[model samples]
Target: MTVYATFDSPLGELLLVGEESATAVGGTALVSLSLPGQKGAAEVRDGWRLAPEEFEEITAQLRAYFAGELTCFSIEFARGAGTDFQRRVWRAVEEIPYGRTATYGQIAERVGSAGAGVRAVGTAIGRNPLLVVRPCHRVIGADGALRGYAGGLPSKERLLGLEGALVP
Candidate 1:
C-alpha cells in the first residue's frame, strides 16, 4: 500500500509518500513529497495509509538536515517510474554534493549531452517527485540566478541557503 506522513520543518509542513506494497521494479520507493498547501497535501485516497513509523529515519535525517546538523543522507531511495532520460537526469542530480550548486546545462552535460538537452533536463528536474530528498533545488540557472522550483522559488532559495550553496 501507498503510505504517507507529514513532517514539520523550518521550510514548512511536508508530506512524504511511499509505496510499501510496490510490486514494480523497485520494491519500495518514495513516490512524492508535497509541501504545505501543495496539490497532494490533502490527498486521502484509498490504498493510502498514514504510517509515520515507516519514515522514522528519513524524518530524523530531514530534521537534522534542516537543523544544519547533517550534510549527507544515507536513505535508500527506490527508483520509481520515469523514462530512461529522466532517470539519468535524476541520478545526475543525486551526484551533486551538499553545499554545492550546478546549472541545468551542467546537469545536461553530465548526463552525456552538453548543450542539447538543457530544457529537457529542466523538465525532468521540474517533474522530480522526491523533492528535497533528491536535491532538485541545487540546480540553478546558467547565470547563477535562482530559477523555478516546484516548491516555489523562495523555498528553493532557503534550501540553497541552508545547504550553504547560495552566495550572497
Candidate 2:
C-alpha cells in the first residue's frame, strides 16, 4: 500500500505520498491555497514507515526547496500515470534546474517542437500531479506572466518568487 505523510511548508500544507520507495507520488497545495480536500486524497501516516531513509529528510528536502537552499531533488519515486507525450514533458520539466523557469513554448521547443505546441505542453504540464516535488511550478507563460496554475495562482506566485523569478 502507498504511504502518505503530511508536512507544513512556508508555501502551505503539503501531503507527500510514496510507495515502499520514498520518492513521492505527488504533493499538494501551497501557502493558504490548501482548502480542506483541495488536494488529492491520500492515506494518512499514523504507523511506522517500513524502510529507507528517515522521513524527516524528505520533509527537510521540501523545506530546503521552499527556502531556496535546494534546487534539484534526489528522491527515488514514481508518478502514478501518463502518456508518452506527458512523460516527455515531465522529463523536460525535470531538466529545468531550480531558480530558472521555462515557458510552455520553450518546453515544446526542448521537446523538439514550436510555439504552436505550447498548448500541448501546457496540457501535459497541467497533468502534473506531483507539484513542487516535480517542480511543475517552474513552468510559466511565454511572456513571463503567470498563467493557469492547478495549485492556485497565489501559490504559483509564491513558488516563482521563492525561486527568484519575477512575476507579472
Candidate 3:
C-alpha cells in the first residue's frame, strides 16, 4: 500500500511519498520527496493512506538537516523506483558530498556517459523523483551556474546556500 505525508520545511511544504519497508528507518521506503510547486509533484491520490506517524523519523532527520545538525540521510528508498539508466544517474547524484557540487558533464562521465550525454544526464536529473534526500540539487552546470531544479532555481540557491556550497 502507498502512504504519504506532508512536511513544512524552510523551503516550503513538501510532499513525501513512501511505502512500507522492513529495512527502512521508519518501516517505510521513500518513493519521492517533492517540494511545493515542483514539476511533476506527487499528489494525494485515491487509495493512498495518509500516515503522518509513519514519517516521524524522516521529519526528524529533515529538521536536523535544515538545522545543519545532520549532513547525510539514512532513509531508504523503495526498491525499483526508476529505470536502470535513471537509477544510475541517481546513484551518481547520491555520491555528491554534502556542501559540494558537481557538473552535469561530471555526473555523465561518472555514469560512463560520453560528453555528448551531458544533456541526457541533465534530463535524468530533472526527472529524479526523490529531491533533497537524493541530493539532486547539488548538480550544477559546468560553468558553475545553478541549473534547473525540480523545486525551482530559487529553492536550489537556498539549498546550496544552506549547505554552504554557494560561492560568495
Candidate 4:
C-alpha cells in the first residue's frame, strides 16, 4: 500500500510518498518527494495511508539537510520507480556533489547521450521524482545560468544558495 506524509520545510510544504521496503530506513522506501506546487507533484490519492510515524527517519534526515548539517541522503528508494533511461540519468545526477553544479550536456555525456541527447537528459532531470534528495537542482546551463527545475527556478536558486553553489 502507498503511504505519504507532509513536511514543512524552508522551501514549503513537501509531499513525501513511499511504500513498504525491507531495506529502507523506517521500513518505507521513498517513492517521490515534491515541493509545494512542484510540476507533476505527487497527489495524495484515495486509499493511500497517512502515516507520519513511518517517516521519522526521513524527516530527521531532511531536517539535518535543511539545517546544513547533512550533505548526503541515505534514504532508500522504492523499487521500479522510473524507466531504465531515467534511472540511469538519475544515477548520473546523484554523482553531482553537494555545492557543485553540472551542465545538462555534461550529464548527457555521463549517460552516453553526448551531443544531441542533451535535451533528453534535461527531460529526464525534469522528471526526477526525489527532488532535493536526488539533487536535480545541481544541474545548470552551460553558461552557468540556472535552468529549469521541477520545483521552479526560484526554489532552485534558493536550494543552490543554501548549498553555497550559487554565484551572485
Candidate 2 lDDT, 35-108, residue by residue in tens: 12433434345673433233455677777887778878766545446788888898999898777888888899
lDDT of 1 by residue, 9-123 (tens): 8778898887774443233356777766543244657878888887887888889999988988766665556889999999999899999999999999999867878999999
Q: Note the residue pairs that clash in candidate 3.
A: none
User: RMSD, model 4, all Cα superposed?
Assistant: 0.9
Instruction: Please name the candidate that would achieve the greatest lDDT relative to the true structure.
Output: 4
Can you give the TM-score per candidate against the true fold?
0.89, 0.78, 0.97, 0.98
Model 4 alpha-carbon drift over 4 Å, by segment = none
Order by lDDT, highest first: 4, 3, 1, 2
lDDT of model 1 at residue 14? Answer: 90
lDDT, model 3, position 16: 92
- The C-alpha lDDT values of all candidates are 0.82, 0.68, 0.92, 0.93
lDDT tens digits, residue span 1-168, model 3: 799999999999999999988888878889989999999898999999999888999999999999999999988888887779899999999999999999999999999996899999999999999899999999998889988999999999998999999643
Per-prediction CA RMSD (Å): 3.1, 5.4, 1.0, 0.9
Lowest-lDDT window of 10 residues in candidate 4? 159-168
Q: Lowest summed-lDDT stretch of 10 residues in model 3?
A: 159-168
Q: Native-vs-model 4 lDDT?
A: 0.93
For TM-score, candidate 2 versus 3, the one ahead is 3
